[model samples]
Target: MYHSILDTSVEFIKGVGPTKADVLKKDLGLFTFRDMLAHYPFRYIDRTKFYKINQINPDSQYIQIIGRVISKKVIGDKRVKRIIAVFKDETGIMELVWFQSLKWVDTNIQVGVAYVAFGKPNLFNGTFSISHPEMELYQNRHLGRGNLTLQPVYNSTEKLKKFNLDSKGIQKLIAGLLDQVIPQVTEDLPQYILDKYQLPDKRTALLNIHFPKNQQDLNAAERRLKFEELFYIQLQLLHNKQLRQLKFKGASFELVGEKVNRFYKEFLPFELTNAQKRVVKEIRIDTQRGVQMNRLVQGDVGSGKTAVALMSMLLANDNGYQACMMAPTEILARQHYASIISLVSDDLVKVAILTGNTKKKERNILHEQLENGEIDILIGTHALIEDKVQFKNLGLVVIDEQHRFGVEQRAKLWRKNVIPPHILVMTATPIPRTLAMTLYGDLDVSVIDELPAGRKPIETRHLYEGQRLRMFGFMKQEIAKGRQVYIVYPLIKESEKLDLLHLEAGIEQLSYQFPRPDYQMSIVHGQMPNADKQFEMQQFIEGKSHIMVATTVIEVGVNVPNASVMVIENAERFGLSQLHQLRGRVGRGAEQSFCILMSGNKLSKEGRIRLETMVKTNNGFEISEIDLQLRGPGDITGTQQSGVLELKLADLASDQIILSEARNTVIALFEDDPQLDKPENSMLKAYLQKLQRGISFDKIS
Candidate 1:
């Protein structure tokens, strides 16, 4: 019977029964024939040869043996049956044992029967033995010229196995499916391109991927799949970019005012870095061209991205247009409002702050003022996107810490304006260029590579717990000079059951060491309510609290320039990028800053490397790249839902050369066939359809 490939009936698959199908569908989200085809193997096992009994070491757990059953006996009771047998090969004799499977031995083995067994070898009572080894009957037809060949092991759910469907059974079903599908699988790639890349045919790749004859075949199959995945993704991103630039037209603001020039001449704190100037110029050019700007501004922590964003907003304000900056949190919003208000004269520019906590009466006033164009600059969190709030002429939308906002949230902001205000997304996390090209290929990228003048580089040092007293003494000396300090911990609550009780215990210890009576101290964590947390943070900012003890909640928004010293407990537990972010909380002002990383003695090699990288340089990009290499791309971006690129087969750090080549290939293809509608581009179209199954195809158009 023929079945629809996309049908949701799991039982229709060859080996999946009702109960087993439920387990596969519920546990793995595999409910269709297409899902099974896409569920690739995690690894392959080689079962080509058998080793002699004498050649096996006692510690060897995975081995194959060819032997004959010399003797058999049952040792345990009926409730707990144990069967043991002795087998002899050309080299020596070994014991084979099974637990709770007496019937299996009786039906499968006899005194003179020869079989092949595979399992881990163990030593019991000075005899080499294997327990519950997987066995197959030996015959002249089954035995190759010598032994069995390579085997494929699949990942399986325990629930499915209870219904008599396991990894081996799934493997058999996939093999059968591939056999039937191979003949129908026509080539979906251009012959010239395939030849240039030396990729195997689609049918050969599928067959070899499922059941490879040798390592070379497996390698060839892997290359074909990885290249195909990346190529299609690149094609989609480039096409989307072309459509956006061609179809959308943005409102352009004329440079007709001296407000920005006056602000730059009279109120500017310091000179703009070369990187910042270059990026601001790019934004100006985009705005003057009357095209919607979808640009990404990326930089390391304290690399002056915010300054460049402010300059862009100034450009919009000079042309009688309103600008809005959306931060991820209320604290960051308030901080930006304060900083920008100080730089620009309050009389010329009316800046307003709107957060979730703003009073209803006050919010109503701000709403009216914003819609009437009385407020030229507005800063807030997600609350700014509420329907009640409106902008008279929103020319530019600057999203700080862009990763914190979701795609839907950003879309809401876009819908607020008639022309979809020009977007400028900023992030402190330094993404490597290769990953940026693959993930954000649809947006123009502007990077700020320089820091402002008189900004001292944070001096980082790694220390063990044994040096705690010395570190404490240093902290005391620094605090004596009237400089504030920040002591950060990983966890908020104290847990007696956890081995790492550093955060809570350290708080208590510091309270005693600094003597809270002498120096005002406060603590903040995520568990605290927003009001209470803000109160404590205000106390620190107002100089009422000389020392603030907190978790990573204070990592992003809190800007305390006076807090020159940062102490991170259990620093090794954090990724390198996280450690750098925590370090960035300080050193924002003219005062020199220091970051002390306290790690335990039992540090792994990777953990040691992370700590050392933090100490060696304050360069966020360099540390981020190293962190990506050591911990991998997943952890560098935080969770899977962080909108960071999730490549199945590509490693951003290791595959740099391949990524560059793929990008160049994509640009060239689009240059020749912009819509990919040429007869020669049919293969590319089919390949993209197969890769991005459920995503909307209109994104390309």
Candidate 2:
């Protein structure tokens, strides 16, 4: 359980000098022997299997061919120049073409020399050819036949290839590093744990990973390494949760007093859904236990999350503590402030809104009221974390769309009070179960799985551009029923590369169709001034306009219950979550609502699936699961910035079993030896410490 000699600089390796070392560090983030070791290959080549030239097809993927070069020639003029070599095996002959570095290939390659070539094949005019295949002189091919089972292929960049550092070059460097450093590596796992898991020792696993003796050894190496990686991640999360709970004594709210009772009895806007009541009860229990509550409230749109949050805030208010809510956008903050004000108008509790748009005089009054405990609840955007804003006794913090804030920004709010406040982050974007397990593992989760009664599911349909005239008839029918409409465009201006509909052109055509005297249209986009955007949104909310033609800026906070139809232009351009959110904008009122997804006839496979999923169901969780499958774990929105889901081997979507097992093991270990002070747990502690040095867990935890 000591530091690795692999921590030595990459430049010290025999094959990597200062120049190549710098390029490796900048391009691949490889600077030390350990870095190189952890840079696992994307795939492996079966060197033992060689394909004949005659057996190769155009669709063949990276086949290894044993052949001899018969002739070499340069073809075409200077502009279309290429080096073509006729290579023949015993079965047949094929062509190897290189469009780049023709001079080097034509001069260095010799005819009638036996060689081994490897690359993907392409077909043109009934002949198979390979472009830029890796070639090596074949000598003593049978000397180490059994050893040529698998060849590791590292990923490389075009820049690295210019310096002669392709996959083969990187493989050579790694081989040299392994020979020099593998002897010094020691086992990090305890003997008992290793025996129980049937995992190999660290030295053996490292060697086998880079150069496996057989398929069995490779499987063992992969399992051992994946376990180590996932184990440390779970350990850090679980350990941090334990430490936080043990150290921080949360403010206690023992009684549900005046504010909660009065709101329920007199000023209740609507009967609380059973789901909302359950979620509030969960929050109430957390607040009264004198333990910090870090909870995630996940619910789909129109699912009463705001009602749950308001009730929780009232719980804090009844205990003589102030509550604050932060949203990702100013408009969302204002919307929350307006709704809460309407709900609590008769109640004695005070509420206020703060954002970048607050004037100097209004800001001063609001600031003074917050310090004097006059404002029981304050909702704002990023302005809530500013230094000038101080609360009398901030107890609970609710963040909507919490992923929009960075780790540091959230940390600033956490440090606002002497004792960190209980945090409740709400998300309308329904997270798939496996993703939630990995991303929000440390927090307690409560899901409001049901929408309030009397809310109708939005009817969604997919339409092609050729059916626009019929779609316009549907829009006019909805408008004639005294309901407003929302037409959302993916782009504000047209782009030459993309043929999708644009907002300006859409509005102009719509204006012509429904004429200005009879129909009023409001336009908004991100590029507009905040004041102008606000004005346009206000028009839609107040029913001053019959239709709002704009971009996705209205996707989140503009709640117009009267709007019964939502038409998304080029719906194929949006992600699954975004399409769901936009659909959520309607279906807020008692009237039947419809969402029309307009797209071109030609659609990619994923695009077709997305539109069809929207048409299939309104369930956010189901859509998220399909999204995880189509987009992958890394490409999901908000995952890239968190750094929590940067999994190298374990797929979040598919490896739930492994993730759960790893989490259970960490929890069991901590339950037995809370501080890892036992002799048997020392190796685990040492390994965890080493892993922590490479990753910054503090901010994330």
lDDT top scorer = 2
How many backbone clashes are present in model 1?
Answer: 1
State the lDDT of candidate 1 residue by residue for 563-618, as single tens digits.
98999998988888888889998898898899999988999899899999988998
TM-score of 2: 0.93
Whole-model lDDT for model 2 versus the true structure? 0.86
Report the C-alpha displacement of residue 677, candidate 1, in angstroms: 2.6
Q: Which residue pairs in candidate 2 collide?
A: none
> In candidate 2, residue 536 scores what lDDT?
92
